[model samples]
Target: MGIPQVSETVERLWNGWELRMVMLLSLYLQIFLILFGRRRKYTAGFWIGKLVWLAYLSADWVATFSLGILAQKIGDSNRGSIPAFWAPVLLVHLGGPDTITAYSMEDNELWLRHQLVLVSQVVVAFYAFTRSWWGKDPLLFVAIPIFVAGIIKYGERNWVLRSASSEQYRNSVYSEMNELDSKFDKFSNSEFFEMTDERLVREVDLNGIITEATFLHEADLFFQMYRVLYADLVLGDSIHLATHIILRKKSAMQAFELIEVEMGFMYDVLYTKLAKVRKSRVIFRASIFLCFVSALLAFSLGISKNNHAYSTAEITISYLLLYGAIVIEIYSVVLLLFSDWAMLWLTGKRKPLFDSVYRTICSSGFLSFLQHDKRWESTMAQHNLISFQRSKAKLTSISLKKLLGKSNIQSSKVVGADLKKFIFQHLLDKRTRYNLRMRSHDPGSNDLHEILSERGDEVFGREESLENFVWSVKFPDFNESLLAWHIATDICYHDDVRINGGNAKIIHQNTETSIELSNYMVYLLVDYPFLLPRGIGKERYSQTCSAVDDHAELLDRIISVQPFSWYESAITFDIEKSTRKVSALWAGVKLAKSLQALGTQDGWGNERKWKIISEVWVEMLTYAASHCGWKEHAQTLTRGGELLSHVCLLMAHLGLSEQCLTTSRLD
Candidate 1:
């Protein structure tokens, strides 16, 4: 009746419960690494490699647990041992196959080492099965599911390596639109501009005055105005839509397509003048491949067997793979939702580029007539024509509080004092203000307005005809300088402050907007002097904003050749249409500035500092462009330069010493 003594090895493992303790420890480690290790910030690939190997080592404990479970049920020691060894065998098969366990692209290099560990585990599992005094059992059927899942995971990892590593995918699509066959070459007549003409209105940024000016030139004012309003409306929609797409649940393919579309639009915008698009396709393919592999792995796991035990290893592995699939799918879904429909919508809002040919319009500009309050009211009325005419208009107006949410500040006040102050402080110079007031400020000007209204009545006659004429009327004498000033204030005060304050936290949000247009144009024209504008028709303009990114450089070069210098006097005159040309020129200049800074500074300091400085400038410029009425001036230059100084100091502390010492002039 004496109990059979356990073997010496089993006895040793039982000393303070070493075997169970090791298994438990292994289980904890695996769970911890899988859940949290991947998210550890700034961890090198080496640690990630170690974690992957840890999962392999831990799988042995899972095998031992399986064996123990089998042993308890079978009663016979020989039958029990077979199931025990099977766990390790399955673990060996499943262990070395993941692209994201380390969450770094470089982690793929460890796959070779994974092969080595995998081989060793296979050997151990084989020995455990054969050398041990264990009998076979039907429960060993569990290994079948595990083996299939392992194969799937391995294949997924391989797919990720192939797709993500491809160089062709990194280029964007917006850069290719300019290459479309130049079918409308007839519109190229207005493309050439004599840059040296002093009479031509120029969009200039002189110190603080930059923020005050919106119209680069009076002749170009309508184009800028059109660009702003169109971009505002369309980009707003895109932002709303992109946010929806990213946050919503969707299939991997759907999400991939959406994100791809966004990238394509960016390419078009950046590369309108170029013949070829660059690397976006490659990156897109890589992204799609990753999601595809993830989907396959999830499919394999979903069909796998369910386990009853809470602590069972099968349940754990199944859950891991299932959740991983969800993450991948969801990530892709979010990406797709954020496509560049917003950018396209905004860019084309000014006017359909195709229709522009018939309309004889190539670009948009500020409307000087809009400076008159009555004229702006007319424009607003025109904008609301459909809404105002709708049967639900009165009801909607009454419920505006509900639809738009409660107004924080009274609408009138928000646009009154703050707006007037902004306009006077930034937009009006003493000379222009004096002249404008003297010519237009008479109280009796309203009588002149009455007289003009009466005179117009004599000409057009009927009330219906007058209303129709009013609706179809275009603004006269567009003021590019004043509008640019408003835009500058808008960017600096409204958008920048809100964004930095975390009220408007959006990723890839900065890339789509009228503000983005202003910053991009300014950077192109002012920063890159040697480049010239190549005449791209309206269709090309639309395409450029929507094309792939690889053509960005080509677009930059083509636009740079146009004369790009900012002169204050240019805004006062009936200058030739050239804001698009200048904007393109500045974009190159801005990019070149970053390059120059990056080139001279050696070590990481140069690259890092220059990049930070460039980003700071961009942020400032974008902010200024969004909120203020400034049309043509690059107003963010002064504030951005000031911020750059502070950023340089900060970078020095973070190992950017040389950049802080470098004394480059903003002027």
Candidate 2:
């Protein structure tokens, strides 16, 4: 074929199917998002988040563009009736899925921008409907209910966005707690309601009811109380007292499980519509469902009369659209029926049919995978500063590890049972000592919050043998302190690896826990500094890495740092130009030498050495948790929840935070 003929044929085909193709694409994106969007919270790999994000953005653009096309078709009076009906369908797509709304906390803040888009699209859709053969066509009446359903769904999207906005979320704290209070009243009459604050302190077994159901109830309750902490508000006495006592009786794993459920609920609120219009969600869902079915049936009947006017492909595509809409409706209903909100709603309701169906579905293996116990991937991201810098120094255009982000120094470890037990036991032991002091001297919680705020000085104060090593802990700033300890920890860990040579399994495993925490903390500094208290951590990290990234001997065996300076660019942190006689990395080396000297002193061995380091690392973890703004913690929940956030919540449950009603800021 000649070029002009080929172009004409391509143009003709596109004109015939442009609207149809976009409609199908819009539906496909809707399906893609609803099924996989929630996976961001549980699934591993960077690609899933990126794919969901792409689909999330595409779904809106395609739907909006379709609305514009429909308006133009109506104004031209070409396929006006069918195009008018489709405008509402585009609105349904614009509403998006129940699985996600805002991809990040930043997306939630742009809710006003979404509001503007919603207004403009609604206007265009309305214009399309009016410009269509309204009076002459019976299709107008059939389109009305569909438009109502579409508007409700789209409006609900904006409502959730607005509700999740930072300004509104902070205001939602008390209202959530108030709702929780009502649920507590319902539970007050049952055996399931046994874990009152005072009761939890004395109870041996942790409360009553079936396992999963009990967790949902507790999740609802805790999210209500601790969401105040999430909003950075002061907790009332009643909220903290109950949480402290309940956490005291439970094992570390149970405490973490409770927090996971709490985070899961928070995720639902910020990223889904379940937490919005809770009292009326059922009514709204039913209304939209009925309207949709009505429109489908109306179209099915009305289309037969106009079958002669439309082409076979157009007819086929229209049915495909209808089927896709039905599938989406059914899928959303399934999600709703099995959702945490559904579980919460079913908690005290003894309606036999709903109750039996709910339990059977939850217990069935066929659908059981949908009901997971944990809400996140449960892996702590690990990055060794010395090792990562070494690899980064050698990075080149053809480096496979850089291309794939497959650096061994940067990875994640599944937070195992041993680690959980150690962490819980450590806190349990701390609380026990505090209780002992209360019994003998009554030091009050004022000192406890002060200690909670310490990065490592608190650990130093409690151990006289660690006094000489206090310089590493009590640095001039938190960022430099983190860098110094990170390097020192890496050195001691590697030296032990060389010395131990696969000895006792138990002792080696203990060493692994401390190394993991050390690596994980440094990982946070490099990748997720927002989760920590405000610091020049990234700057110090860059300075440290830039200093030693190319040092062959140090890395073969590798490290540096400085304070944040507005006047000085990070690139200017050249090692030779530093004001200090001893550079940051060299200071860490000196500290490591000091620790190595003490490793065998006073009958101390590698075992005791790592134990002190392990304990101090935990203190640093808690310090980061307590000092970080709650808003930062909440923001991490949508991305599978952070270990820091979990520890932070655990500390609050144990009454370790300044936000705890029993603790006063001594400062």
Candidate 3:
């Protein structure tokens, strides 16, 4: 059997006219997406553009059959032209350049690989173009605008990156100005501001500065109590909010983990609600069916003879390609429709559910409930045990003479003014400066040995009191473990320590309280604010006040902890890391707020802007506390909301200026 031949004329028409038109259209679509798509709406543009490009690249196969048929009519004997000129060109396009790729992040990586690919593709494309001298020069014309558009898109992205740095700098300076105004405004309205007696929210002078050291110290002071407020949240209480925030922050893996945790907890909460489960199943099934039907129709049309299919081999391949696409679309649509968002809404009005769950977590009256996982429990226990031992030591002091068995020298007399002697004589072999600070006096060799003995016993569970203790020390381990414990500290203790005017106690109390209060306030604003008191006689009002006080104390403590010797450590906590931790807590709260808005009478149409504004307010609050530092506490308000507000003001001014510029340009 002789192979069918494709005439040169038919082959030229297939490549020059049909293929060029499709490629040109795809390029235009990509350009449209780059200009109009919102930052958050990239998913829509990405998939659509991807599919269009795929189709354009695959269209050659579709043209092959028609060209072969035309050639056959012309009585050509040799097999049809392979369209080999396009094959290499298409390969070059697939490789992409340094400026563009399949992903946005890839553009930012070291460009050696991209440059190599770029050079190779350029060479390959030129070779293909030289070979592809068809009767019409359709590709050259089509490529021109496509090339221009690609350059513009690449340049625009680069401009955004370069411009954002300056924007942030200008934003910072403007923020500072706005912060001064806010402080003045706050000070002026001090009378209008309600005062609280709780240790956490006790009004304190900020001393007119915001330094990094102070910021971290203050954050440390209150984050503990905030962690407790969302014990349920931290331990996986509100799955919908937690899951949404995780996904929003682009932490899909963590979001899935949170979902698993939520599902397990929900199974316990909704154990009796068989009807809800049945409803979910029905929705899931229906969505799946619809997706399947759409995909099957699309696939069937693609495989039909009117669409493509030339030789028996080509027909088989085309059917397979169509089948794969159909499968992909069906799965995607099914997943989207029955997603976490849909299932959550279908779970019925869950505002009350969220509230009930939150309250149960918060007011269980069991402090133990606040700790998550065994590691946290161990850390807390270490904190408590140390405090308890320190209290016992203060209460029961042994004289040096008694310890020396009636020796003439007193321990205090021998130690003199040096506390190191006191510590080493009684407790451990060596002592840290922090240990001396904890004692409120220097520790000598005897004192050190005694302290170490007590510490070891507490740590190793040598005594019953030590074994039964809830926390081991005032502070636990120094690294990730201790910090995590501080985040879950109790509010009452913080209040007491603040009243006592003790630094060690205040430090512990304040850091935990502040972080907790911030987290609590966000949650209240977002999900459980109804539990908060409106004006007076609200049951949770006192609790809310306490949380706020703790937060204020946290802020104060952070200011006090400033001027750390190593400022580099402070700068290491860049925006991304700070925001990651902030976002994790914010996610649950954001979900709650969104849900609360939805459940209201008007369905949230008018309130969307305000809701967004509130979130901005919270973001500002945290960012100020975390980023602006103790010395720059005054600047905290500026970097966030005040700064953003200032930018809006600038844009307004800039817009007027722009209009004037345009008038001048026209004139």
**Per-model lDDT:** 0.29, 0.71, 0.28
Candidate 1 on 70-182: residue-level lDDT in tens?
A: 33433244222223323342342233222123234344335555556455544544445443334443234334444344434444444333333213112211122112112
lDDT of 3 by residue, 255-332 (tens): 222322222222111111111234544553355334334434543554463333234543343334234323433443
Error of 1 at 230 (Å): 30
Per-residue lDDT over 198-251 for candidate 2, one digit per residue giving the tens place of the 0 to 100 score: 464233222433445766666666777777777767654345545556677677
Tell me how many clashing residue pairs each candidate has.
121, 3, 87
Q: What are the models' TM-scores? A: 0.26, 0.87, 0.22
Q: How many backbone clashes does candidate 1 have?
A: 121
Ranking by lDDT: 2, 1, 3
Models sorted by TM-score, best on top: 2, 1, 3
Evaluated with lDDT, which candidate comes out highest? 2
Cα deviation of 572, candidate 3, in Å: 38
Tally clashing residue pairs in candidate 2. Answer: 3
> lDDT value for candidate 1?
0.29
Q: Which candidate, 2 or 3, would have the higher lDDT against the true structure?
A: 2
